[model samples]
Target: MAASNVAAPLSSQRPLAIEARGLVKDFDGTRAVDGVDISVPEGAIYGILGPNGAGKTTTLRMLLGIIDPDAGVRRVFGHDRPHEIGRLIGYLPEERGLYPAMKSVEAIAFMGALRGLPLAEGRKRGLELLERHDLGYAAERQIRQLSKGMAQTVQLLGTLVHRPRLVVLDEPFSGLDAINQGKLEGLIRTLADDGVTVIFSTHVIHHAERLCEGVAIIAGGKVPYAGSVEAARDRIPAQVRLETRMREGAWTHALPEDARREGDFFYFSLPETGVEPLLKTLIEGEAGILSLSIERAGLHDAFVAIAGEAAARQLEADQAGGGA
Candidate 1:
């Protein structure tokens, strides 16, 4: 079993909105999840990331109490069963559907009603949300009449109508275009800014990288890593990118032994001796430095390093297959 860092050092001080331990799930005779564990801090944007069929959705279902785990335990806002606090939690599942016959605002209201908001209040808030989101014109339109992106936005507004404290979104960016994806990302940030805890699952590393403070990397029904995004990224060394007009000089000797060259650019891990000596060498050796930057490894690079290239490849394949 792989070790799990269920919480980051900083998040450990905050109250947790969700926690799971030794979560196990089986489908027929196949073990789909094996001893998965995760911790989500209150009012944080967390991500559960994995390629398709890696048990991302299954783990989320278990957390939301949509399905019972075969073994282990989970708690949402201190409730063993999430449904007991359903109104305080909002979920937008991977399989999205709204009534094609119902008007957009009515649909949002109806969804709010399911979460315990009164119909009249839901309808009032539904319209307000639509207008606030620039979807006021679509309020009276039937769901089937709206574009896919518009309909998805309507569903999302419904998810927020009851002002849930914690929101779980499964593959929320799967079908969105670049523009709508940006919009969703902004909305997620807004929610977190308002002290709402947002947890989303995605195979797209960029989305998780940009939006999540913490993440759990699930693979083959197990968690390989679960902690701050920064921690995951730190597992790989910071990369130093150096571009110089002079291809070769005495300054080349100052580069890390493992440094690789492509044209006039050199890429390598930041040297243990640090960059000051390197800059001095380059300047004195007259190595015509055009650009120099040292950057932490991005989440994509970290994902490939931690989850392996096969999982990374599958993630790319899944995104390509989804056409988003």
Candidate 2:
């Protein structure tokens, strides 16, 4: 992990909203975020994606100033982080921040007030948000009385009541059912549409794929892939799988350059030449095609490929160091 000290002032040009250069954090002896460089343009819905123990939570904590990085510079809304974090950011931690004994309205209002909102205004916004999230009737209900999903909704409402410029959420969908997940995704989109910069971390790749305009995939505390979803998919190969009941010998010669057989199915890599010749050959061979479809690499595949490569490299390094 890189370490440096410069304590530079925030940028005068439209405050970055959030920026971290060579951010590094260590817990005990293990490095959590190692040399991470992240920049979120104002009003961009950026996603930080990684599997469990990928240091995503730690990175977000560093950004929020909940936890200090051992090294590197972090700024939130162009101000030195944590020092001015409350003024420009709203955070929803993975472990929901609510007092279980408190009523829904009280919990929401308390969170808003923590961000400097007056109690009366916080209560008004809390009630409105609760109603919007379909939990208005539960306003008087204690947090402990709510289901996990309902509590999650209240937590989200707390995060938004202040309407901070940048909202940072860590695994906001962890306890949500499909319906609640959809609801939260919609709300996130609405927030971004309202010109709020949203940065969130999630292990659920599909949600990130659907919600984020820009993404950074972190593995082993380092970003293996970062870009738009389309660009990430473009980094992988394109192939097509054709499943057929045709005789094995009949279409053997019609296979593409990188074709492979799995039982009755033929998985072929589409060559630059085109797929026309292969289709013609199969048709001429009188092959009974059960299904034929183009297979495009998805975000999940790209994530696995990149993370797998990083893990492999780490393994090799461990072995080399051991031998030395």
Top TM-score prediction, candidate number: 1
What are the Cα lDDT values of the candidates?
0.89, 0.78
Residue pair clashes in candidate 1: none
Per-model TM-score, in order, reads 0.92, 0.79
Error of 2 at 148 (Å): 2.2
Candidate 1 residue lDDT tens string, 1-324: 233434444345779899999999999999999998888889899999888999998999999999999999999988999988999998998888999999999999999999999999999999999999999999999999999999999999999999999999988897899999999999999999999999999988889999999998877787878889999888878889999989988888988888999777899998777889999999999999999989999988877777778888888898779832
Over 4 Å off in model 2, which ranges?
1-16, 242-255, 262-265, 272-292, 309-324
| CA RMSD of all predictions | 2.5, 7.5
Candidate 2 overall lDDT versus native: 0.78
lDDT of 2 by residue, 1-324 (tens): 211211222122444677887889888899988887777777778888876677889999988888888999888877775656585678888877678899999888888898998889999999999888778899999999999999888888888888898899988877677899889889889988888989999777777788887777787887766656666665567788898776575677778768887887788777677778877888788887788888778877766566675544553443334321
Which window of 10 residues has the lowest lDDT sum in candidate 1?
Answer: 1-10
